[model samples]
Target: MRRVLAELALGVRLAFAGGRRGWLRTAMATLGVGIGAAGLLLAASVPTMLDGRQARTDARYDSPGGVTVPAGRTTILAGPDGQSGDNAIRARLLWPEAPGAPLPPGVPAFPGDHQMYVSPALRAALDGPDGDTLRRQMPYEIVGTIAPAGLSGPHEYAYYAGYQRATALVEQQVAWRVDRFGYPSLDVEAGAGGTYVIVAVLVATLLLPVAIFIGAALRFGGDSRDRRLAAIRLIGADSRAVLRMAIGESLVPAGLGLLLGLLFYLLIRGQVERFWLFDVSVYSADVRPVPSLAVLAVAVILGLSAGVTLLGFRGVTVEPLGVLRQAPTWRGRLWWRLIAPAASLLLLYPVLLGRENVGEARTGIGAVLLIVALIPLLPYVVPVVARLLPDGTASWQLASQQLRRNPSSSTRAVSGIVVAVAGAIALQSLFGAAEVERSIPYDKADPAFLLQARDRTSTDAMKQRSARFEQVSGVRAGTVALYTIYQKDIIGLANLYIGDCRSLSQLATLTGGCEPGDTFTAGSAEKVITIDKGEINPAPGVRLAVPAKARKATLIGSNAQGVASAVLMTTIPAQLARVEPGFVETRMFTDEKPAVVAGKLRGVAAEIDPLAMFTAMAPEGDRFGPLRVALNVGSTLILLMMAVGLLLDVAARLHERRRILGVLAAVGARDGTVIWSVLLQVIVPVAAGLSLAVGAGTGIGALLMRLSQVPVIFTAGTVLLPVAAGAGLVLITTVAVLLPAVRRVTRTEELRYE
Candidate 1:
C-alpha cells in the first residue's frame, strides 16, 4: 500500500510538473473537458427536470381524487359550446369527498361552493384592465388562484368550482356528461410511444457531436505524453505503473473540469428554468440532479477520461526503444471501412422499402447506424482523396504527402465536420418532406364568401341577411344554410344543415343531383325515419323519394360530410322549416372582398366576425416552421464546433511540425510555399470529408424519410447551402488557425532550432 501511495504521489508530482511547464496546453485540454462535462450534465438534467414537473402536475390534478365535470352542465350560459363566444369559459367542477393523494407544493386546497379558483393566467385575463369588456355567463366569487402546474397549458383559462354546486347544476341541466373521475390512488401517466422515441433521437443527435469533440480533445498532447511515459518505463517502471501514471495525469484535469462543469451548471440553472419544457416551466428546485446521479456522472466522466488515456497506449510497448521508434506509418485496414455502411444499408433497405414490419425504435437505430457508418470510412477515404489532388505546386505535394502519412489524425480532426454536414442535409430533407401540403382535390371553384354566425339564428333572419348580402354590387349569387346540433335516434351528434336544394347545389357539389323544384334526401342510413323514435339505433342509409316541387324536406344524419355526406336539400319555406339554434352560414359568390360583403350583411345579422381582405393571394406550402428553425440552429452550432475543432487540431499539428518546418526554412524554402502547404494540409482532408459527407448524408436522409413514410423533395438551395457553407467554413478556419503558424515557422529564429 505504501509503495502504491509513493507511485501515486510521484504521478501527481509529474502531472503538476507537466502543467507548470505547459500551462496553456493544460488549460485548453481542461477547458474542452469542462465544456463537455457541463453539456452532459445539462443534457442529463433535462429528463430529470421534465419528469419532476410532470410529477408535480400529476400531484396537483390527481391528489384530491374527486368527481369532475364541465361547468357548462350546471349553468345555462350563452354559447355553451366553449368556442367563439364571449361567455365561453372552460370550467370544471370538482367534488373532493375524501383526500386521496397529497396536493403538490404551492397549490391550495379546493374552494367551497359558489367560490371558485382560477388559473393564474385566467385570473390575469379576467382581472386585467380590459376584463370588464369580456362578459362572463355567471358571476362566481373568486377566492384563490391555481398555479401554472394545475393547468395543462400556459394559455389555458379554466375555473375549478366546488362539488355541491357542480352536482346540482349537472342534475338541473341533464345534458353535460361527467368527463373524469379522479381517485386518490389513480396515477395519470403521460402518453408515450412514438413521441418519446422522437425525443430520444433528438437528444442523441444533439449530444453525438459534443461527444466526438470531447473525445478528439482528449487526444490532445498525446504524442508528447507517450514519449515522456516511455522514458519513465526505461527507468524500471512496469506497464501497470505506466498505466497508473497516465490515469493519474488525466484524472487531475478531469476532476477539476468536473467541478468547473458543476459550477457552470449552478450558474446556468436559473436561466434553464426560464425555458419551457413540455409546455411548462419547471420549478427551479426541480431542475437539479439528485446527489447519487451527480456522483455517478462525475465518476463516469473520470472513468471515461481514464479509459481514453489507457486506449491511447493500445499498441505502444512499454520498452523505451520501441516507443521512440514508433511512427505514423501504421495504417488501418482500408477495406474494413466499407463493411459497416454496407451492412447498415442492407438492414435499412428492408425497413425503408416496407418489406419489414418495423417500429420507431428500429427506424431510429437504422438512422444511427447510417451516421455511425460514415465515421469509419474517413481514415480510408481521406488519404485516397489526398492522393487524387492535382500536384500543381511543391506545397501541394507536401500537403498531400502529410495527409497520406497521418490519415487517422487528419480524419479525427474533420470527423465533426462530416457529422455536421450530414446532419444539415438530413434536417433540410426533413423540412422539404414536411413542407408538402395535403389537400382534398376539388374541381369546383371555392366559395368567395363564407360567413358563419355567432350562434343559431332564425331562418327568416338568415334569409334576410343572405338577401341583403346579394344586393351588394358584384354579388352574383348568395345562399344561407342553417346548421343545428341534432341528436339522431341512433346516430349521435349530427350536424343538421337545412337549405334550398338549388342554392345548396350551387355552393357545394351534391352526390345526388338536385333540380330547382326537386326535393331529395340523401344520408348514410337506409331508412329515412324509424317508428320507434325513443330507441337509439345506429342510423342506416335511407333512399328518400324525390318529392315533386315539395315545399319542405327533412333528411337524417350521415357518416360522411361535405359533398359525400347525406344532406337534406329541399324548397322548404323559411317560415315553416324548424330553425334549431345553431350557426347560420351564408355563402356568397361575388367579385367584392369577403370583408366588404360581410360589411353589407352586418346590418341584417346580429354579429360579424373580423375579416381583412387583400386583392391577391398566393398558396403557401405547409412547411415545418418550428422544426426548420430548430434544425437550422442546432446544425449551425454543430458546424461551429467542428470549425473550432479544426482550429484546435491545426494548432496542435503546427506545434508537432515546427522542427520539420524549421529544417525546411534552413533549406531556403519560400515562405509562401510553406503557407500554401499549411492551408492545403487542413483544407484537403476537410474537402474530401465534406464531399463524402454530402453524398452519405443525402442517402441517409432519403432513407430516413422513406422509413418515416415521408416524401423526399430535394431543392437546389438545400443541397447547395450546406456544401457552400461547409467549404467556406473550412477555408476561413484553415486560414485563421494556420496563417500565423506558417509565418512563425518560416522565421529565421525557427531555423536556429535545427
Candidate 2:
C-alpha cells in the first residue's frame, strides 16, 4: 500500500510538472478534450432523454414486452345502402355518441344506427342531435371530453393516442403495438417507425465528441509519459508498474472529466426535462437513472481509452544507458494489423446509407466510421497539408517547416479543429437540406394563392374563389391536395390529394415518369396511377389489387407526390370515388410565368418555425423547442471550444518556440515574415480541412435531401455560408496566435535565448 501510494504520488508530480511546463498546451489539450467530451455527452444524453421521455409516453398505451396487434385491424366504411360514391369513407372508430356537453335543443340527431363517438371539437361542428337523443340511440355516456394533448399546428395533432386507442377499441380492443407517444407503432423497418427520433439523433451525434476527444488525447499526449516511463524503467521499475502509473494519470483526468460531464448533465437536467414535447412527466418525475448504464458507459470509455493509451508503453526494454537519450518511436503491430478491417468498415457507410433498411445500421456505422477515420488519418494528413502551403514570408515558411519537422504537433493542432468544423458543417448541411427539401417543388409560379377551409361546406366558396383567382389575367393556377395522415384508422393515413393531376408534372420532378397534362385530360378514359419513388408496400410499376370490379390503373409516378402513409393517386373523379365528395379539394398551382407571387410565397404552407409551432400547439410543456435548441447550441459550443483550443495551441507553440522566433528576429527577419509563417502553416491546413468539410457536407446534404420526405432547396447561401464561416474562423484563430508571438519578438526576447 505504501508503494502504491508512492507510485501514485510520483504520477501526480509528473502530471502537475508536465502540466505546468506545458500549461498552455495542457489546457489546449484539456479544453479540446472537454469540448469533445461535453458535446458528445450532451448530444448522446439528449436523444436518450428524448427517447426515454417519448417512450414513457408511448408505454402508457402499449402492451408490455413488445406484443403487437394482429394484422387486418384496418377497415373501410361504405356509405349506407351500398351507394358506390364519395360517401364510401374509411373510418376507424365510430363511437356511440359525440363526447361533450348536451347538444343544443331542436338539433337533428344522426339518422344512422348509433355508432362512433365524435370528438367535442368535431361534434360541435355537427348541427344536430341533442345529447339525450344521441345517447338514447346509442347507449354510451360522455364521461369526459378528450382531445390531443398539444399538437404543434392547429391542423396537426401532436397526441395521436386518442385515435390509436379509439381504433383499437372499435376493432374489438385489438392489442396494437403502442409507441412512447401512444400511437400505433408502425413496423417501418427503416424509416421513422416511432415518434422518438430525437433519441436516435442524440445517440448518433455523441460519436463526434467521443471521436474528437480520443483523437486529441492520442495526438496531444503522444509522448506524454515516455520520459517518465523511461526514467522509472532505468531504476529497474517493472514495465507493468510504469504502465499502471501512466494509466492512473490518464484515468485521473478521465474520471474528473466524466464527473464533470455528469455534473454538467445534472445542471442541465432541469432544462432538458422542461423540453418534453410530449406528456413526458411520467418519466421525468420518477427520474430513476439506471446507475448501471452510466457506470458501464463511463467504465467502457475509460477502459478502452486507457487500454489503447497504455499499449504505447509496451515493449519498453529500457536500458539505463539510453534513459538519458530521446525515447524510441512506438511501433505496435496491433493497431497496424487492425487498420485494413477498420477502413473496410468505414466503406460500409455509403452502402448502409443506401440500403432499404438503414435506421439502426446507419447510426452504428456512422459512429464507427467517424472515430476510426480521425485517429489514423490525422497524423499523416496534417503535415502533408502544412508542407503544401504556398511560399511567402519567412515566418510563414518557418512555421511550415516546423510543422513538417514535427507532424505530431501539426496533428494535435488540427484534430480538434477538424472535428469541430466537420460537425458544424454536417449539422448545418443537414438542417439546411431538410429545410430545402420540405419546401414546395416548383420554382416558377405566378399569383399562386393558398386557400384553407374548415369542413366540406366551404367547398363551393373555395372553388368559386379559386376560379375567380385563376380567371384573372396572367394566372395559370392549380390546387395541391393537403393529404394529412388520419391516424384513427390503422390503414396508412391516406390523405387523398384531389386536384388537377395534369399540372403536377409541371410543379415538381416526378419520381416515376410523369408528364404535365397526363392525368388532366379533358373527358379522357385513360387510367393512370402515379406513385413516388419512396412509397413503400405498393411501389411504382407494381400493380395494386383492390377489392375487385374496380379497374386497376397504369402506374405514372411523380416526385411532387406529397406526404402520404399510403398513396393512391388518380384523377379527381377517381379520387372522389374513394373518399367523401364534400371533402373534394382543388388548388391552382400557377406557373405565373410573367410574374411570381406578390410576396414571399416560397414554402409558405410548409414553413414551420419549429420553436414557435411547438409552443403554439403544445403549450403545456417547455420541452420540444428547448430540447432541439439545446442540441444545436451544444453542437455550436463544441465548435467554439475547438476554436479556443486552436488559440491555445498557437499560444503554446509561440511560448515553446519563443527562442526560435527571437533568433529569427535578431537575424533581421521582419515581423511580417514571422506572422506569415504562422499563418501559412495554420491557415492552409484549416483551409484544406474546410475544403474537405465542404465537399463532405455537399455530398451528404444531397443524399439526405434525396432520402428526406421534405422538399429541400439548397441555395448558394447554404453552401457558401458555412464555408465562408469556416475560413473566417481559421483566419481569426491564426491571427490571434501570431500577434502575441510578434509582440514578443519585437521586444528583443531572442537576444536572451541561451
Error of 1 at 360 (Å): 1.6
lDDT of 2 by residue, 595-650 (tens): 23311221121121100100010011122333346456665665565566566566
**CA shift at 538, candidate 2, in angstroms?**
22
- Index of the highest-TM-score prediction: 1
lDDT of each: 0.57, 0.43
Q: Report the C-alpha displacement of residue 127, candidate 1, in angstroms.
A: 11
Q: How many backbone clashes does candidate 2 have?
A: 39
- TM per prediction: 0.73, 0.59
Worst lDDT run of 10 residues, candidate 1, spans: 611-620
Model 2: which ten-residue window has the lowest total lDDT? 609-618
